[model samples]
Target: MMIALTILALCLCTCTLAGELFEPQANAQNTKASGATIKADPFQQRGLCRRWAHQSTVKNGTLYMFGGSMLLKQNNTVQEVPNTEFLQLDLAQSFQLSENTVPWQKPKINGDTIPPAFSAGAMYSGKGDFVFLYEGQTPKNLPEQPSSMWGYSLINRTWQMTDRWNHADENFPNRQSRGASVMTSDGNTGFYIGGLRAYENDTFKGWYYGPEEQFTVIDLAAGKKSKMERLPLGQKRIGPNVVYLPIGKKGSLVLVGGTGEYKVRLSAPVQNATKMDGINPDDVRLNPMSQMDTIWIYDIDAGRWFYQTAVGDKPWERKNFCMVAATSDPDSSGNKTHHIFIYGGGTDYMTPMFGMNDKPFDDMYILSLPAFRYYQVKLGDVKPDARQRMTCHVVNNKQMLVLGGHRVNSSETLKDCRWDELNLFDMNTLKWQTEYNPSDPGDSKFIPNPDVIAALGAKTQEPALGWEDEDVKCLFTGICPGEQGIEAQKKRSNARWRKWYIAVGGAGGALIMALIITMLFLRRRRKENKALRYELEQLQLYFQYQTTGEIYSSTGVNNLISDGDAFVSEKVRPMTFGERVKFVFGKKGSNNQEIPTIFDLPSEKRRETEVEKIP
Candidate 1:
């Protein structure tokens, strides 16, 4: 070791350009590492061949893909090869250079901790340290036990299985159907409803039961396994995709279209479809409602299930497609409604076993919120080939990166996914793009699809979808949070009306009282004036009689006799009412032989208090 170090030191001293030598060394350090554990260049060692049904998820900007089947051609017959190679891709680095396909990396993990997990659900927990796999098919293509929860730790690169309901050091429960399951945005909880199989299976006696009667919650953050109060009776499904939107504290799960069959039975029509591989178009017996294109929603906070139907030309009832959601940013582009994108799946495996045969149902649809209408997205000139069982991961809140799917029918050529391509969809414009660029604003504004609008017709001012359930409506629009929902809006409306009612009622009552008081004032003034006019006429007549006749009185005898009798018979008038009012007020009573108005107070107060005279 010392001799090798001395020679390397001597070579470094002899080199002319040290900076150039170090540059390639830095690149080599990333591509080729310490041992045989890592791969060179593309970084992906497994899952390079044609495959499908693999599960994928993104955590901390890295895409982890694993567990699917590979299709191989041997002489005259098609072969189905089951794969268990866990791989990853650096999305931040891959999309920046981004050619025909996104790049993938293989992390050689050493363990036999988990069984075959192709049709299982994948979720990240504890802030992205571990990715948990829900129940799926075994290597023999049989259903895995519902009680067993398998998890892979990214930090340790090891897999370990635990009891479903039992938790000692870690948390797991929340079984998902063969369809699909979704976790909360914070990575703490999982929400799923209507399992095709039982989570606590004591015996594998039945393949399907009467529609699921349990709504389960696998709360990793709280470290408990429990069931919700909602038990909706609906058709059982396989390969359905679920989405968890954070509407309230518990959030809600949207159960979109899935394969409506519980068990696929191979018949003559399906037999001629394709000579395919593992779980390829199973002779599954579909439920009635599956063909009806139903959407089931479970509101976690309300603990209830709601049923809805879409009006647009919804893609024929199919499964094994990718569905992803992103909130809208009206300030830049798109409407204020949230959007869920559905793309690239088939009703059955219709790809020709030998060549590129375009399958039916090879289209995309958009489920825009608040209006819950389906719009067939107009695919641009460049579109992805028809495929099934692919995983779509949303990136940077603007685009969805579709990765890793295969046509089971194709043996020699790759039709569904190109191993060197990046499949991207711009959410704002609802357009498909081969390259991903952050600076590119996909669309300045999103206009509604005319076909869907025509089908939606004129709505009756109520929410088209969430009209039945307020909480479910809140999940989609500004209905529940930030005073943006109907309940919040109604509360505000009632408050405003209440204020107006109080103000108008109070003002009207006061005006009515003022009118009554004014009428009484005028009536009292008229009555007093009438009496004053009569008294003034009598005084004028009495004064005239006294001027015409005279009274002479020498003593009491003469006062009683002569014109005194006539003068006595005449009526005399007292002082006018106006003069009496003046005498009582304005200090006139003090000058007239009457006690001063201020001194006329009750005896005790007259001497002690010097009251001021009236003005």
Candidate 2:
């Protein structure tokens, strides 16, 4: 089970770093490396590859991706390599391009500090003009460090490591982060939430209830970060997203879907997720995280947390998925809405059911705020293949810029969006558009979800999540004695529909089928496992006792007999000429040499020879 978990977890880790891992090619310039200047083209800087679990952010009309696992060819062999390349694409140029193009600029870094290969928590700081990356998973072969920090200037094309990058600092002890998400709204201050920390073979590898609620508030401009201790989630989450909404005084951080612990519940289990009868050995670790079970919103100004839920076309709970939020501009009435666009993630184990879904979502969802409802976007004829671990960003307030992800399952066809390295989605038209246009419509408002409107009427019903603190209510409602919904906000005490819905038919079906499958599978698997255990034991004995390099079976004819092999035991039988030739020269690839017996003289011959020396 541990081994299985390790493999799956490692693969997930692989998927993400394989994400932002690509390095952009410097534009026909010379760069310094190892104290020597080298032509950029000769350095083999390239574009993005199929990736996931990458660190990415958009700032100042440019999208930056760094640190991810990517597939690269070295000496004719395809290997999973980490991308340390800084990839950038100008939003204006990309939106104006005509045909398929990989417009990535891999700037020549001017300093020693470089982006880690994968799993680094990162954000783009606008005020400082730097991309700050915090702790990340290093290559296993490399020496592990206490997590540190590094700042890369996109403008000056340099990396910086000062005293602030120290890992020994008591403040930022939560250094090692994997499967975490980082985001910034103002571009100066960033928030990093939910990551597996201090994971190892010795521990549960961050499986269950571990770590105090992970919510590190980073002040990038100050070169410091603080782990907020006030609010704690009941369970630890992996790969969760922290989206900043400028709602309350200091704003609210919206905590979206990721893997939660202990509680095994689902809003609507995907058909693929429900197929597994019991824990498949290969996917035991992935099952719990595949359900979209919860959402929590934290009010920074009030220092409190409020539970929230979504209705209408909700996505099945999943992990290793990516999402980005785009708030609609305020309308004529000063009414605004927030839209969280979600795409591509792995589902529950499905080998028993339909055969594949390890990276199984090609669908998309829009969770609009204020209305607080979900709306599934209708895709055009062309859409991406099922994939996961990719990072996405909202660009130009109109299109979603998706970068670096892979189809973990080879059975599914891998589709690059028009261009090979990136995908562009038009939020206005709800289409996977091939042509990029700068003058196209902007993402100014939320297109209505009729299903949501029908379910909750025009106004959003209030959440029954009664607040313990008056301050929190005020923060949520945006006024003292806050009771009125902030422009159709769902803060009313008696809103009919529940926060999170467990679809009766779907949940019941999943529960019943799961129980039935578990019972039967347990019964059958027990017998089979017993037999398998016995067979494995016997094979272990055979390999341990029957095979040895000193024996005639494993080694060639042991003519240089040790005292143990002197006797003519059947196990030590001599080989035929062909067998000897095959063993020594061909199949066995051993040296062919005649063994000289220094003590070949018989007893009589020994006595006769010794007579002369009998003094």
Candidate 3:
């Protein structure tokens, strides 16, 4: 019997699991059969093939993305070759253009005179429309830093050389694939943070150790360089990723997660130096590898560092995630709140086996401040399989467009190959929508390089052409060329008023409810006090009559005509009709024991009393 019961239970469990698996599909089919198709976004398109080292920058109504390496076949060898040219997309026109009808036309800038192929050491000066090109790896075996600093100007449509052009100085070290630069809008200032430099000793040939000596702040306007600060060093140190936050007028720069040294080194000293008090050179040791989860904020005006505390339900400890500043305000404040959106990168595991299973991250997160909260966005109800090194860009206030990255799933043939799926996340709704790029069918196919997917939108419809007055105004207004244009001031004002209304209404409602409750309690207490006083007064009168054996009436009448006894004298008489009634009710009846009546009470003559004389 027990065996039969167990079999029945197993069957029931299997049926339940099967029901759950097919329930969603059944519902979806029913909805589809009713001719209700899910809403599809019109602007979705397949991205172009590109490399990780490409440079992307936004300018007047256009997003200009330039050269990076792409895999090309030469003879029988497949190798990464640098892209010579750049592409420009008119964002204003793109936003208004229908995805089905209009295809992205890549316009060549400076056709044959394009700069040589490079990667990593490129910086952008947002205000002047110039990109500062410096050190990067070449197709040749040599890791090279450009002999001269090249400045490409967007306004003049030309490259210019300044007196400030020079290679990395002794204190300012440079090497390819080590650091990145971020430019502020104030024109003259920018920061060059964390890169590698070559170091050599007599015993060993020179080798490149990354996350080198110190970060440098380059004053392009002044043509001077200074060390920003040195990160704490121990063991397993890596370069830092720096980005600018331009929401406020006096904007600040943010440094996200990076690798740091933790190990103590042990070595014998060759010469006698001032012995450090806590640190012993002879007993040197290197600590374990640790990834830094700390975020450092640099104030441009104050020139100081302030730390923000870590937040989120499950905070991520990661480095090299893509960080982008969200320029549009969801709160409708013309003063756009700075939002830093971070996605996948490599992680340090602090173990002897490094890179054994180190894959890129697919998780997406956003950091919003003044509130200082990190929300792990749910892309779908179910978590996606792990992905790493993905590229992401904010398309607008509503959506963040994400492109290819390396996946961790080992069963697939393209184990370390790039992903081809185009995923779109609606920031407002936190929903993930995916579309397979028809141009690039699968991971194995030659897909667009991850770096080429720059943030571009539709162009304005009214102007009809790229070179028009309305077109210029639309771009300068901070609206992407296509989709619904942003009305900056009006939207911000409405958001501010809405927040104010919620706060004020909440406070007023609470106070009004408290006042009403207090009034009701006081009114009920007053009624209870009146009823209690009436009962107490009656008790008091009854007690007085019982103790004194006298009644004093308000009409100057005494109800108890007492005999001359000590306890029952005329002086101790009931004073009022009310008091007399109390005295009569207080006495026991002579007839039946169950009933006590005033008429059955003992008469004054039959009552025994004793009188006490007082001086």
Candidate 4:
């Protein structure tokens, strides 16, 4: 019984806890009733493969997108064509292009060309109005060195070459694959972080590079030639997502989730390879295979690393996820809180390389710094598929625009899928609204809208709220610590059962005491009756002697007399002790008053009455 009550308490407690965590707000019904409408873009279903690139700069309300690789295939062979031309898209000209009406057309500039095709390392300097393009593979028959860094100025409408950057130094590491390079606000500096580096020889004995020491600060104002910061060699790590966190009156850089380096033994067949043979078989240095969800913060002012708390429930540990930071804020001094949005990355390490046929995630997560609150923004019901290497850009403070990524189908074929549609989520509402081309005949593919691209460069309406000092306490308090509240509620429920048991036990004890007392009283009364009977017998014997005066002394007669006295005592025995004295007094009263029990007294009265009637 006790165990059942405990289980019941636990179940109720769990229900209450769950309700607290995921209960829908009462205002949610009101918001739904209001019914928000989102306009869809006309360019959602176009079968175009556009490489993800940053918005170069906003000039005269026109947003410019530069060089990106486009899919150009022929004869069953697919090749990526790098675009050098600048496409100018007017923000005011945004409208549905119809046959009768002319919409704002994106005009391509012939003279303004960017350095050839690149996939990953592209960043824009908003203040300088220059786009920095660096370190992407050139179309070559064999593996070639990536040696060029190009800059295109939108304001001057010209491309300039830097002599210092052209000169290669021994300290400067080689270009890496899937590496990230971002421009600082000063517009003259670019920070480069981790990716994969080329293996020089077959032996693993060669110096391990491309992981820990792969960070360099490029001074574009100094003609791109900058000295590397010499620091102690840490563990080799890669695939790190880096973002600049704006500190109060200062700035800090934060890096989240990357793989590290470790030693692995190579088989003889693998060891015989050119690059593998260079390394000792016993100590083959390889990129560390650990997936990191850890966030490391680097203070720009202090030149030190400070670790922050991990955000979110165990996130899907993967690489190449899309991340973007807030660029502009119309409210307050600037974007108060440096928010980083992360979405859609691969979970399997071997999957990206070996092509594990699995679906990608569609979940969106936000990391708000200083407060370090990780909010899992509800994206509603979105089916997951492969979306590795997709691009994300912040369109104002509320919405993010996501672009093209690879989708793998059941046949194990990789198809270049463009989410030609833009998904808009209001930060305040946390509800998703999609915009796409409604007129398009093809099925609408989800893509980040280009209008969002325009919005990214626009100033935000308000600066985001940063984490205050009190947020730390608030965060800890909000967390359900070991289900303490649940346990307390369980105890409260159990208290009811405890009260019931005490009541029942008290009633049962009273009843048992009453029954025992009644039985004892009845037993004592029976003993008293027996004692009164003995006293009555003795009185009867005394009465017989007084009534007779002289007695015949014969054996038979004495026996008879004794028996008769015993019978009279038994018959006339008092019902209670008090009754014995009353019986004795009543017999004496009848004798004194000459009671009518005597037959001679009645006959004498009858004879006297008859003589009086005859006269």
Candidate 5:
């Protein structure tokens, strides 16, 4: 009897797998025409090779991407390499790919090129007609702090050095990674905030020891910057999404979810202390700071900071996420609002759903300012997989394009690899479109016009005809079929096997029939077992709550505690800043319940609750 049941379970599992195998094919067949396909390649290199943490900005009708890390085959082993070349894709022509008409172009960027790249900050200044590049690490494992800012001209197609905008007191901005940068609406001021850094004076400390608390503001009009402003005391952040929102006379720089350093633990002291002991790993201690789930807003005009307590389902603490203000976001009145879109990031702070640093999110979230409301956008089944360090840009008012990111699956070993294809999310339609690039677009390389080159006093190099050289082939693998193309190919390749399975299914129909009858009985039994298991879990949770008085909410909302006296209102009102801070920081309610504070009450006016003893 036991053996028969085991075989029955195996057959059911196989049936489930078989059903899943055809799901993609079914969806692909349904949406094949609507799916975007490519006629020409857009990437510099191919075969799913990607560069991470590069900066991209849209200007006029072209999208400019520059600098980052790419994984390349180096002497049989794949290694992460820094890329300094500049690539541009014509937005007007990107919708349709063509072999005859090259859409992606690269201009010969000569004269004071970007420092050997690592992930850096880059933004387009609408007023300047130039893109500004700022603080990032170098190939030699040092921070690149050029005295002057590097600016690329869209009008003249030339690179020119510009004034260095830094804190007058600090002299230079701290070198860091995953920091957020934004320019104001007027384009006369820019801001850089929240980066991961190690103490420069101490070499023995481990990497990611701390986060930079201060932010630098640059006055593009004045050709200088104000003094560095420190973050709230005791609050250091890295990888936070910072954006500027202009109000009547001034603006606010809003800082969103980020990771910070919490504590460090030192190992036992070594006997017979020596000079090297201080630098030993056992002696040096470090711990990742807890994720600062709270949101902080800096009023640039007032030179003050305040907490923004949101009122909806808040996003979890994440790092390496890309955020861009949705200039096209309309409010209820059909007016532009300060709404920021956050997408694709890793949640290392989340309790190990799979394992450590293994969970990346594919979901998108919106944070509306002043209102400080948060809600996740439900993108249909068609969306990019979980990834981080991607460049997401808002374009054409209602479209978001994501390109070049890294993902580490649970089954795969961790490495610095990037996804090659670009994905677009239609804000209005809420549809996802993955652009296909079959081969490197013929015009991947460019030589500036002779007249322009002579005027700039720089020589131009001829572009490579193709990936014909052996070394070039090794460095940049040829393009790979995109996800859609690969799916179609896979279906065709498996057609014969699928036919065989169908023929065998005919012969095994009797056996399948008998198994189906058995499955009917087993299905009912499984449901009963599931219900029993759920009941057991609830009972255990009930006992645990009774003993500890702490009950967690899986919805990512506020946790509820049970003493049988809590009154959870059917309609919970919005909470104020003081009440939110007091409740979120772990104060009990007036009725000894773990509920959020009321909107209209001040902290001093609310009476403290007495502890109820549970026996």
Candidate 6:
């Protein structure tokens, strides 16, 4: 019975520890009612708007934004602004609607831990609690530094400079800024897709898609000295997004729509090219397709690339769109596919020579995978402004949080644009809700619309499909540690069970032995007490006979023996189960001495002090 109680107590402790790791689902319901914006009275006013090339990622229930060029209006002209500030938004604090305002905290940076300003793509390593900032364009005024990769640890709240991999170096591929990058499930391999080269005074030197579509692969674990390999791709991609699909033996990488390749050569004159009227006779410019409707898939395990023809209604070709896998479902055969949601982006952007322009989009589309199908979500009354280079994050698989991106306002051109407002799209309701008003221009709470809530009363469900399971080589074999084939996993599981059984059996045997030993000791102590009592009784009878030459009453002798037995039992009580278990499992005394039994306890009677006796 004591063993059962001990096991119950241990189980309770284990469950309590596990509960602290994950929060309860009650917050999900509260979030739905409160929307996404956090409003408090005392809030920090942080300007997250008008920043370009910045990246955002969610960690520890907080949103972290890093590295971007700020566009500030100075002296009636837009100027490229650089700063040494990093931003983090605490979701828990923001959700407290009781406060009138919500504030985002900027962590303190000591010395040169984080560079003042750089424009680049950043990725969050959830496994390591680190955020990697890739090399990107920097302002001209800043000191020229070697191209390098950097890391910021969320756990340590510190930034450290990592190894340098120069894009201009012959060893590396073309320089990338608006390119697509995605880390493998293991967070070791990073695949960088196509990006345009830096525009020189008169020409673009290394266009990623100039006859040769190439991508660079980096081993993130190796840091700066990591092997940089440039490999050929199917076609050139500019401003595309890559999604890692972790399903099959080796998961696949999918590249969504982007501006396809355009080639330029200085060797020959080009005809029918835009803005070639007064250009040099030797220069030729190729006009790239504004947008691509094609979707590219790369099989990581097989080192192969394939395209699937999506049958349903499809979205337009776009670039810099926010695309994320909101959720996934598995079939009866254990084959899983994800549901991807693509949001607003631009359609057309030309090279500097031809004059740059972008046609933004505000539509949303859902691409169901493995089946390669598309479903357009119609926004009835509300729609987000058309913007590109913006970031969208999924919130609990129910809503998408849209953050900062620049767009041409009614009175402004592309060069002079304003930041878009924070928007939230409900996946279930198919409605758009304003989250934070960067304009303020203050943090404001959004009340839910009654009509939209009524419309979303019925929950949406995904259609089921039957699929055939094919034998595929495991691409993620070592990527995810300990994840293996069914047979191997089963064998390992069986071994674990065997070891656990052995340990439990050994502990149980020890506990039983401890119980038996305790019982024997108690019995021996009782016998010794009885013998001592008998000896004392004999001595007491001798004393009585010597004093009065008369035998003591039989009743008096019985009472004396009874009193002795009670005293010994009170002094040496039996041990509780908890005490026995501790004796068996707890560390031994000095010199590895055996645990003391109840009989070994001090037998001294306490002497009352004067104050205690009076009290």
Off by over 4 Å in 6: 1-49, 74-77, 95-102, 140-145, 167-175, 186-188, 199-213, 220-234, 262-287, 290-293, 331-337, 349-356, 409-421, 435-615
**Model 5, span 1-615: residue lDDT tens:** 999999999999886666544433432332232221211122435422445678777766677877665555333345455555467877765453222233457654433334334355555553566766655544333443543455776666555556653333353333455677777777778887766432222233222413233476766554344545556544455556777665423556767765554333122123334321121223322323222224565656546454433444456557678887654334354444355778877654322221224356688876654344555677878777778777877666556778667665334543533443477765544557554232244422222123322322211111111211222121112222442232343464367446655877755755655665587457545644543343334334433444454544432323333333344333322222322322221234564544443222332223244311110
State the lDDT at 98 in candidate 5.
20
Q: What is the TM-score of candidate 2?
A: 0.61
TM per candidate: 0.56, 0.61, 0.48, 0.50, 0.55, 0.55
Candidate 4 structure quality by residue, lDDT tens digits, 1-615? 999999999998886665443312212222232231211112232333333432233334554454343443333434334334345445444333222122223332224233443444544443445555555433222233445566666666555544223324444334444555555555656666665543232232122254333666777664463644421124344445777645522455667654544233111112234331121223322443322334555555545443433323334445666776653232354333345677775543223332323344566676654445455555666433346555555443345545444443223433553333223444434455443222232322223233332333332222122211122222222222332332343464467446755777867656654665576457445544443343334333333433442222221111111221111111221212222111211121323321111111212111111100000
Comparing candidate 4 with candidate 6, which one achieves the higher TM-score? Answer: 6
lDDT of each: 0.49, 0.50, 0.42, 0.41, 0.49, 0.49
Whole-model lDDT, model 3: 0.42
> Candidate 6, residues 1-615: lDDT per residue as tens digits?
999999999998886555432221222222233232321111232332355567677766677776554555533454444443467776544342111233556654433346435555555553466766665544333443455677777666567877664444443333346777777768767776766544222222333332332465666665442443333233565677878877544677877776554343121112334431122333333533322223456777655444433424456556778877644343354544466778877654333411224556788887765555566777766675677777777654456777666564323534433334356777655677655322121222222233432332322221212111111123312222243433454566567556755777867756655775687467546644543343334334333433443332331111111221122211122222222210010113345422212221133222121110000
Give one digit per residue, the lDDT tens place, for model 2 in 1-615.
999999999998886554324223322111221121222221233322345556777777677776655554333334445445566766666343332355566555653445445454554543567777666555433334455566777677677652133333333333445444544456556666666544222222322222553666666775455563322434466656666777786787777666654332221233444442122222223224523423567776545565443445667666667777776556575666676778877664452111234546788887766556677777755887667767777766667777766675534443432224467787766778665554445433445344433554555423222332344345544545534333223343123123222445556656655675587457545644543343333223223322341223444344433332122222332222212111111111134322212122122111111100000
Stretches > 4 Å off in candidate 4: 1-64, 72-88, 91-114, 140-146, 163-173, 186-188, 198-208, 211-213, 220-225, 230-235, 262-292, 326-338, 351-359, 382-386, 409-425, 436-615
Candidate with top TM-score is 2
Ranking by TM-score: 2, 1, 5, 6, 4, 3
How good is model 6 by TM-score?
Answer: 0.55
Instruction: Give the range of the ten consecutive residues with the poorest summed lDDT in model 3.
Output: 448-457
lDDT of 4: 0.41
Clashing pairs in 6: 40-99, 40-100, 40-101, 41-99, 41-100, 41-101, 249-475, 250-475
| Per-residue C-alpha lDDT of model 3 across residues 1-615, encoded as one tens digit per residue | 999999999999886666544433443443343233331111232222223445555455454555444432323333334443345555444232212333334342331233455544454544455655544444333333343345666655554443233433634324444354576766667676554443222332332444433455666663344434554321123335667765333566777664444333221212233421111233322321122223456656535344433333323444445566554434344423344666665443321121213434567676644334455554555434455433445454345555334354222333132324335555554556443221222222211111211111121111111222222223223453442222443355456556755777867756655775687467545644543343334334433443454344433223444222212222222322223221222222344121111211223332232111110
